[model samples]
Target: MTCDRLVCANCAAPVNEGRCPVCRASRERLQQQEGVLGALTPAALLVLLVALVAVAVLARSFAG
Candidate 1:
């Protein structure tokens, strides 16, 4: 999803290079996107899932 590897359809060049107006525009748009979540890693997602499970287990024990 990052612009570094994207090719510009208008100029047939890499978006990161900004070889043309179209490339520059596209790169800018991609950069403005939200943080690493827009490109989440599997490890991070796994950690989040584990945390959620732990919270649910703790809540159940407390209620019992």
Candidate 2:
């Protein structure tokens, strides 16, 4: 649940836009809880996953 999809009940706007104080505070809190990888887009994370799999496959091949 990224902030991008969150709705601000106080401002009636998307949380990511932070239209009001409440929205801003909520966005900040959510971002903090999400950590570093949580900020990454789905596509970027997918690429990372693929890269990790490739690395593991290469490592296994080398070890054998």
Q: Per-prediction TM-score, please?
A: 0.60, 0.74
Query: Candidate 1: misplaced stretches above 4 Å?
Result: none
In candidate 2, stretches whose alpha carbon ends up further than 4 angstroms from where it belongs are: none
Candidate 2 per-residue lDDT, tens place, 1-64, comes to: 6788899999799999999999999988987898888778899999999999999999999999
Task: Give one digit per residue, the lDDT tens place, for model 1 in 1-64.
Answer: 7886788899899899999999988888887784768666679889999999999999999999
Q: Check candidate 2 and list the clashing pairs.
A: none
Error of 1 at 52 (Å): 1.7
lDDT of each: 0.86, 0.91
